[model samples]
Target: MRTHFCGELNKKNLDQDVTLCGWVNRRRDHGGVIFLDIRDKKGLAQVVINPETIDTFKLAETIRNEFVLKITGKVIARDNEMINNKISTGEIEVLANHIEILNASKPIPFQLDSMETSEEVRLKYRYLDLRREEMQKRLRLRSKVTHFMRDFMDKNDFLDIETPFLTKATPEGARDYLVPSRTHEGGFFALPQSPQLFKQLLMMSGFERYYQIVKCFRDEDLRADRQPEFTQLDVETSFMNEDEITSLMENMIRGLFKDLGDIDLPNEFPTITYHNAIKLYGVDRPDMRIPLQMVDVNEIMEKVEFKVFSGPANSENGRVAALKVPGGASISRKQIDDYTKFVSIYGAKGLAYIKINDDGPSSPIIKFLGDEVTQKVIDLTGAKTGDIIFFGADKSKIVNEALGSLREKLGNDLKLFNKEWAPIWVVDFPMFDEADDGTFNAIHHPFTAPSVSTEALLDNPGKSLSRAYDLVINGSEVGGGSIRIHQSDMQKTVLKLLGIGDEEAREKFGFLLDALDYGCPPHGGIAFGLDRLVMTLSKTESIRDVIAFPKTQTAACLLTDAPSSVSKSQLKELNIKVTLPTKN
Candidate 1:
């Protein structure tokens, strides 16, 4: 149907005749000559129909944007004045001798080039939206990233294996997307939140190295970076330790970005333990690009007359920490008040601060504090004349979370980041956490292996540490995995600690527990969100931009008007009832 892609026609084909079939990007009539900017997946080419080709000229005059046209023309050099230096094939234009209008299109709802177009309108007409050059390029890059991942994994002897989508749901992390069993009455199968369990079972079955680019579903609230259904680059291997897995995965990503060429990421990503991350940055996943770190001032604040600082300083489950913002005295009262409100979202009762004026300790709270206490705080935090100190005090959780979040906010607000890439491994996480009910829950899941020295079951559970590790890229958790409990006793112990008694554990995860009993090897794997990965690589804020068709915030497909009401007859066939009135 065509001689070549539109973007492929260049200086080499200046005198060659060719047939180009594409959508008319635009049609311009100047004097008696018509110029059609024809576009296909590869890109665009200009086709000129002169007055000499009367029929072709007449047909070209009727063409509009998005009109599918077949054109046969001879490639010729464009006039120097007419040359478009911006385009790759700007030196040449095809002089059309014949034209065939294959299809006519209606006017688009909105122009593709306009930045002001609303997201709702774009999502509703997503097929047309995907035709835009930017979107086309993103999809192409996504394909390339996946291809690179597969090639890397295969070269490392990882088998591309698949797991079941409809499997029994266990309490892992998120709510499962439940699918009603139509063939089996009243039963349900839940969509996998991940292939976490199955991949571990694969190790027991003796598939040492495994990988899969698989779809996963979670029933959760939506956000810019989240979707109800998403893809993951799942990888797992047997008998390999954390160091080995980290090295392999890092090399894979390094090679991937090398092919990308725009940004050169670090070869060695730093390692931060869970405890150190909290102590230094107040967050488990710290953005290394940011220079600011949290400084403890609990001992210094203990003797202060200011009850606000002193009360929390000496109490259990309380903290006195400060963030020393470099050159922060320039911030206004309005901005400080705004930041105070920001931290309140994380349960921070108040945000205390001291602006380091030439006079020193200049803050509303400073008047209530003793001189010794003020000197200790300044000394402890190494507060300088140009720095501003922000403090948080309360429960340990509130102190760390609020201050941690504020650190990230200030980095963006103050533009204090280095603007370079920083990736790291967050390791040595606690195996169990005490829930609000005073019961223990697995921090990363029950199957995770306890560190060698901490593997004692039913005794010293509090001191246990998991072999889990998270791959953090610029403060975002990209992927996570842990060595699995190959022993059934350890698996049972972890489950019992999670408050899932034998009966319940057997009901929900009997198959997995059974697999562990039958000679399971120690295996671990990581799963990266493909959509989020592609978005990060493309430097896009919204994951929806990279997805071909994405649901709205409420998880409704605008293009198809999905989650619509089903007919009563169909509902009866499934032995279901629609009790509530239909929402219009």
Candidate 2:
């Protein structure tokens, strides 16, 4: 209980008596005079306890870092020489008449401001870690982000509606986290991967515009940007086409950036088709900031005698492509080997290159290509004197993955970004990808509407495109959505193409199918990954930094020691039995 925040006092409050309660950030001593820095969410303020107040001085002397304290003092101006220009309260100090230690603290395991602390230790002591100023600022910004989202949605007549967290499991791409039923034996409810179906159902239910800031779960392998559980800004609307929906969503994002970070994103984000994005940049979500692009050398290499390039170039599913890195001829042999190893992780067999030197082209494979063919490659790629052309020759999948990833890595490693913020819309994605066994899988989801009729789609499913679109910022997909197939027959047709039999579809998605029959309107919506958006805005590398309680890379919660066993009696009531895989 204090009259004023410790950091709020400045020279204007000089001679004003105040009661400030906070933790002792630091304790200092000059001769016999004792000084303590009191800190709270606002910031820090220095408190001076002189021997003139004997009891307060004695109490202040015992204070240590993180010691919670309540101070009764007078705000006084600091001497000009004693002024600290770094902090807001620097122009003044609190002359304490009384000091009360609200709580004492043991020595902290790590300093809050230290950068050298391991992420494991920080996560283990997440409560203490969150007390750091940087953590406080980030969480505050997160609150502001949600506030702005809600306000914008409300202004646009979007209803804040909720969907079930414990629901039936449907095929959404990843494994779902299931909750065992106690009342019903052998029954389980899966956590929602997203509110995709429910949101669409809402449109059918006549709630034209619906939105929810919701939690979703997936039992999947973890990465820097992924988590076992994450948040999504789920939205759905009725009677809006793809163009109308994208325009509105773009405005929301543009306003968010300009309002929150004072960063002005483009009014109309550049658009790229899925086919061109893959062919030119090797990835659908291309970082336009990177100037590098993949060049197709299939025709040029197909005639060459070198089997390494000619072999893949001649195959139907194979590709021969080159990435021309400007001024990359200066890279050393060891660095080139390192890049080759990097691409190998993406199933690339090897990386080949031809460096354009001032004297002419040079490479180990130049002898294989011959002088005539080598010159053709140089001319085809428009290779300059100082440039290096890195080639990928393999199945199209491997080539795209290897070269796409390498493009991003080189962009960062070589500082080749052409702009700071590059947002683009990747559209016209193929409706389905055919497996080796000839079965089809939906590229986005089965519910996504195809651009062609059901019969047309069935005729050539591989070439059919979806109305789906994704919003990408700096190569990270922030949001994605597509027009929905409101017709029940169309929905079932797409499901059929995905190898889902009628009985299986009825068992899993009967509710959605049944709802679609009841006069559903033309509708579509987008879901933004809230954690990824904040991570991008805050310029943090990992989603964990933005989350309050995040699991480790292995998806274990260090703080709670979660995924622990329950009592035997509790398991018996749930009718569950434990099973463990034998170690090799």
Candidate 3:
């Protein structure tokens, strides 16, 4: 409908006649002349209808903000003082000769350029919200990211194959979104949490390498970075070990960051084990940007007179760890008390601290710890004159989680981050995590291949390690994968370890087991949360900003009023009967 985009006209188009069809961003009147700023998907262009263009100027006077209009004009240079330095097409303006109000709009709920709009109002009118330049650039960058991924995978000889959206439900550490089977009574198909099993099956089907930009669903509670439905860049390949796969994927990520933001990643990403990451940083996905580490002081505190330290120090499942915050003597008492409450979220009974003042180590617990053990702690943590050591003495789990997370918090609070981009691979995860009930649960998934054989894993599940790896950038876990068990017997062994018996395994994953028997190759792959990745790259705090029509925190669509109830007739047609429990 137009010869040139609103943003496409600059000095190069001066004196050339052009037509633009867009929404009028604003209408201004200076005496008899009318100025209209027209906007399209590209951007905005100022159009002036002076008194000389009598009919056009008359129509332009009736234009308002958001009025859709088709304008025929000649691009002309703006006065030196009138030029806008902020916009790309600021060097010139268009002099309108003809103007047509294609569509008129009522007063908008809120101005698009205003930043004071609430999230609820913005989401309710998301179409208008997306018209803002920020949203346009974000979604456009998302498209470019996906396109680059496809091109990279294709060049690597990876097939862009697809997997099913509806499949059998299996335990993937999250509740499945189940779809009722209208034709088959009570039967249901669960939306995939990830194309995990099917992608593994594809490897057994002899596709050497594969990748898919697929949608995934999980019936989990929502968070800032989570939604009911999200997109994943799923990948699987045969004959490639974790090293080969991670290396290639790392290259793709490096190229992506460099291409999109001109940000150069490190030449090589560092690697850490799951055990060490938890010990040092308290989380499996550690944020390496933080220049902090938790130190063990259990051995030194074991014989201390203070039972608070010695009690947990001597126990099998307890720990006494110290987080040394360099130059931390500056922290006020109220801040320390605030931190005490912060760690309580992870089950910490209390937070103990000693300030290394010029006078000597000082703390309320120092008297109970005695001069000897207190001095030893100072020496153990390499406490300097201005350093402050925070202690966590509780069950090992509680201590690690509290202290580890606190270290990251302090890093941010103290502005101790050493770099902006820190990528690392966390590998050598345990095959299973032991439950208090003496049961075994796969750390990643039941299908993840253990570094040890089935017999060794059965003999000692805790000692067994998986060939799994996770890609962490900044603080977010962007992608994770593991080698799959190619042997049917091994697959059955792991499933049985997970309490899924032969019958149950066959029922839930019979197709995958059958494929394994036909000859599966040693395979491994990773899946990246595409939204989380874009959120990371865009430096946006919320995932909703990266999504077009995201749900609210409660997972309801404000724009469409989705998750709405169906009519009784439609339910009857699906052979379903409605039942409701009486409200309390």
Candidate 4:
């Protein structure tokens, strides 16, 4: 229907006839001459209609924004003052010889380029929202990213494989999105949380290397970086150790940035143990861009008379840590209170601080600690004049969560980032995390191999570490993987340590255990959250912006009005019944 895209016309095509088809971006009538900004996937180009062409000029006068049209015109150089330097085809305009109104649109609910539109309204009209230039560019970049990943994987001899979307549910950290089955009454099929099991099976099936850009679903609370369903670049390989697998994946990611965004990552991403990451930065995925770090002050605080600090310092599960913020001595009382409130959301009782003034140290808690202990803390934390040491004294988990998050907030609020991009590998994660009741849960997954022998892991489950590693960029975990337990005994042992009894393990993952008996290869793999990766590459704050169609934080689709009710007959066919809680 068109010879050239609206954006493809330029001075190089001057005097050449062209036909363009697109939506009318804007229509303006200046005296007798009419101007129509036509837009298509390529981009925008201005079309001019002279009064001498009375029919076409009359039609152009009636056009409005979003009116689909086809224009036959001759590309011409724009007048020196008329050139739009901001756009690609800015140097030229199309002189319209004919205009065809293909379709007309009703007045749109919101302007395509308006920044003030609420996300709810934009989501409701997502088709229109995707037409915006920014949205178009983001989606285009996302396509290019996926394409580059596929090309890279193919070059590495990884076969693109498919995994079943409808499969039996296995424990994968999150609750699965179950699909009711009609063939088997009262039975359900769960959407794959990941192809973790099937991909392993693929390796045992002798594919050796497999990759898939797959969809995964989780019935969980949503956040800016999370969704009900998301895509991941899933990969698995045989006969590769942790180092080889991580090196290859790092090359893929480093090359992705270099090729797609022209951003160069380091030759080797720095690595840290999970314990050190939490101890220093308070989060395993530390934003190395932020220079702030948490210092252990438990030993110093243990001797202080202040029970608030000393109590946690002396307890086994408790911690006393301080974060030194440069030039924060001038922070006002109100700002400190605000910060206290911020940390409180993470279970902190309050945010204590010792401000190192030019005169000397000062704080409300100074009198309780006395001069000797206060000076020791300042010395220990290296809090010089003009620095403020924020303290978190509580259970270790709460302290880490509160202080770690506070460090990130302080970095952004103070503009303290030292670099634009920081990529790091966090490894040596604890195989299991102990629950409050002393029960254990796998840190990664039950299938992840332990760094120690099966007997050692079983003997000291609390201290056992996994072969797992995570790829974190700018404090966001973009990918994670671990070597698999190829032996059935080791897999069962890890599951047993996680408190999954033999019967439950057999019921849930018997297929995997049975497959392991039949020559499972020594393998490892990684799954990169495609949405989060794209969000980082595009420098967007939310993954929703990068996704084509995304649900709200409540997991409702405003556009489709999904999660709607089904008829009683349909429920009966699936042998299901609805029950509602009685209102009090």
Candidate 5:
């Protein structure tokens, strides 16, 4: 329908005729000489209809924002005064010789250039919203990134294999979106939360290497980076260890960055133990770009007279950690109050601080602590003359979360972070953690294999460590994976330790257990969240911007208004009933 794209017109095509079809981005009629900014997916081009072409000029006046049109014109250099330095096609304009109204559009619901529109409104009008330049660029970049990954994997002999979307529900780390079977009456199928199980089965089937850009679903709560349905670059391999797989994936990421641009990524990714990450940063996913780290102050606090600090320090499940905010002595009282409220959202009872003034700890709580205790805090934190320290003391979980999150906040507030990137592998995670009810649950999943040395601890259970690793970038968990137990006995033991009895394990994962018995190869893989990864590479903070279409925080599709009720007949066919919760 068109000979050239809007962005393709330049000085080289100054006298050539071109046919272009796109929407009118803007229209201006200056004393009957009509001008239109024609836009397509590529970019914008100016089309001029002079007074000599009176009929076309009159027709252009009907074209408002978003009116689709096709024009045949001769490209000509724009007068110096009319040149636009912002675009590549800035040097020239097309003088319209022929014009046709391909389609017409009503006034759009929202402006394309405004970033202040509500996400709901933008999503509802997503087709128009995607026409915006930024959205188009982001989607294009995503495509390029996927292409790069695929090429890199293919060159390494990884097969682009697909796994099932509708499969058995094997509790693959998230709640599956189940599909009811009308034919089978009571049977149901589930959307995969990942290709975790199927990818492993592929290894058993003798595929040495595999990769897939696949969609996964989960019936889970939403976060800035999470959605009910998401995409992942699922990968798996047979007979590869932790370091081998990690190095291969790390090299792939570096190659991708280099191919896209000469972006200098670290030659080698750093490694950290899960235990050390929690103790130093208060969170396993710590932002290496941020120089600040948490310091243990429980010993110093235990010696103080302040009960607020001493109480938790003496308790079994409690901890006291401080995040030293560099040059934060000038922080206002209001800012501290704001930070207190921020931590409260994460279930913290209160936020404590000891602002180091010109002399020493100057807060009111400083009076309760003796000189020795105050000096210990300063020494332990390595606090300089201009630093202020914030403390979180509570149960271990609360202390980690509050203090961990405070580090992120202080980085932004005090501007103590660089824009540089850092990727690391957090290895040797606990295989299981005891819940409040004393039941043990898999920290990663039941399928994750424990280190051979820790296989004995499976009998003790509380001390077992898994051969799991997470690829963390700037504190975000971009990907996670583990080596699988190819042996049936080891798999059974690990499942048993996770509180899943043999009978239950057989009922849910009997097929996998049976497969292991038949001689499954030693296998492991990683699944990178495609959305989070692309967003990280693009330096976009919100994952939603990377997705072509994404739902709101409430998990409703504004464009389609999905999850709406269906007819009673539909429910009857699936042998299901819709019930509403009773008002208490």
Candidate 6:
């Protein structure tokens, strides 16, 4: 319908005849002349019609915002004083010789540029929402990101492969979205949480390098960065060890951020052990941008008479830690109370603080903790005048979560960050985590190979570490992976430790076990959460902002009205009966 995009015209094309197709962005009447700003996917262009062109001018007067138009015009330079410096076609405008209205739009539900539009309304009218400049730009950048990744993988000799979406169900932490089979009564196919086993099988099938920009599903609770179904840049390779794989992936991220985001991410990301990450920052995905860190005060608090601090300090699973915020003595009592309420969300009873005022350390709890212990804390945390030391005394997990989360909050609120961008590699994760009942759960997944051998892992499962690594950027776990067990025996041994009996193991993962027996290579790989990656790059808090169409937090698609009921005949064909549950 047009010879050129509305945005593609400029001073270089001045005096040339052009036909453009787009929606009317804005319409105005300037004296006797009519002006319309037309917008397309590329951008907007201003079109002018003079009284001299009586027919076109009259047509322009009828055009309103969002009316689709096809215009044939002569590109002419705008008077230099009249140029709009804000837009791409600001220096020039189209002098309309002819105009055609393709479609007319009624008043929109909300203005395209309105910032106060509710998410519910925006998502419901996602088509109109996508027409906005920000949404179009985000989706376009998302396409470029995927293309860059595909190009990088291809250049690195990674085969872009596909895996089955409808695969067998197996325990992989999250619940699966099941699809019923018509041919076999009661049979179901589960949507993949990932192509975990299938990718491993490909290694056994001898595709040394493989990658896929694939979809994965998980029937789990949603978050700002989670959805029922999500995209990942799935990757796997054989022969290469942890360092080789991590370095290559790091380079990809570094280059992507530098080129696409215009941010110079760290050339060599710092490495931290899983244990140290928890000890220092409380979370596995630590935001190193935050200068705040947790200090172990367990030793100093152990002998104190204050039961709140000493009791947990002496317990095996307990901890007493401090976070020193520089120049935070200015913090008000009300703000401290607010922080106390915040920490309580993580199971902390309260937040304790010692402010280094002009005179000396001051706090109501100062009397309970004697001068000696208080002085030690002041020295350990290097608390000077104008500093405040916040304390968390509870079970280690509670202490870590409360203080760790508080640290990040304070970093943002108090502006304590040392830098804008921080990326790190969290390595040496435990092979398994111990439950309260002394049972074991895979730290990453069942297939993750331990850094130690089968005999060694069996002897000390709690102490065993995995050859796992996670790529964390600014506190988000963008990607994670671990070496896979190549030998069938090792896989079985690890599975047994998790209380999966022999028969159940055979029933659930017999195919994987059977495949492993047939020459599975020593391989490892990571899957990058593409939505979360884009969310970070786009500087958006919610992954949905970057995703074209995302479900709500309740996992419902309001636009499509999905998860709807099936017809009786359809259900009968599948040999299924509806069973509505009774409300409590």
Backbone clashes for every candidate come to 0, 0, 0, 0, 0, 0
Predicted model with the maximum TM-score: 4
Q: Candidate 6: misplaced stretches above 4 Å?
A: none
Counting only residues 3 or more apart in sequence or on different chains, how many pairs clash (N, Cα, C under 3 Å) in candidate 5?
0
lDDT to native, each model: 0.87, 0.93, 0.91, 0.94, 0.87, 0.93
lDDT of 4: 0.94
Scanning candidate 6 in windows of ten residues, the lowest lDDT window is 55-64
Residue 83, model 2: Cα distance from true site in angstroms = 2.5
Off by over 4 Å in 5: 453-455, 582-584
What is the C-alpha lDDT profile of model 6 across 174-277, one tens digit per residue? 99999999988999999999999999999999999999999999999998989999999999999999999999999999988987989998779899999999
Instruction: Give candidates' CA RMSD values in order.
Output: 2.2, 1.3, 1.9, 1.1, 1.4, 1.4
Could you tell me the C-alpha RMSD of candidate 3 in Å? 1.9
Of 1 and 3, the candidate ahead on TM-score is 3
**Model 3 lDDT at residue 255:** 97
In candidate 4 the C-alpha lDDT for residue 481 amounts to 95
Question: Lowest-scoring 10 consecutive residues by lDDT in candidate 3?
Answer: 54-63
Off by over 4 Å in 3: 29-33
> What is candidate 3's TM-score against the reference?
0.95
Model 2 Cα shift for residue 505 (angstroms) = 1.0
Between which residue pairs do clashes occur in model 4?
none
Please list the residue runs of candidate 4 whose C-alpha ends up more than 4 Å from where it truly belongs after superposition: none
> Candidate 4 on 45-111: residue-level lDDT in tens?
9999998888888788888999999999899999999989899999999999899989999999999
Q: Which is the winner by TM-score between candidate 3 and candidate 4? A: 4
List ranges where model 2 is wrong by over 4 Å: none
Candidate 2 has a TM-score of 0.98
Lowest-scoring 10 consecutive residues by lDDT in candidate 1? 452-461
What is the lDDT for 436 in model 5?
Answer: 83
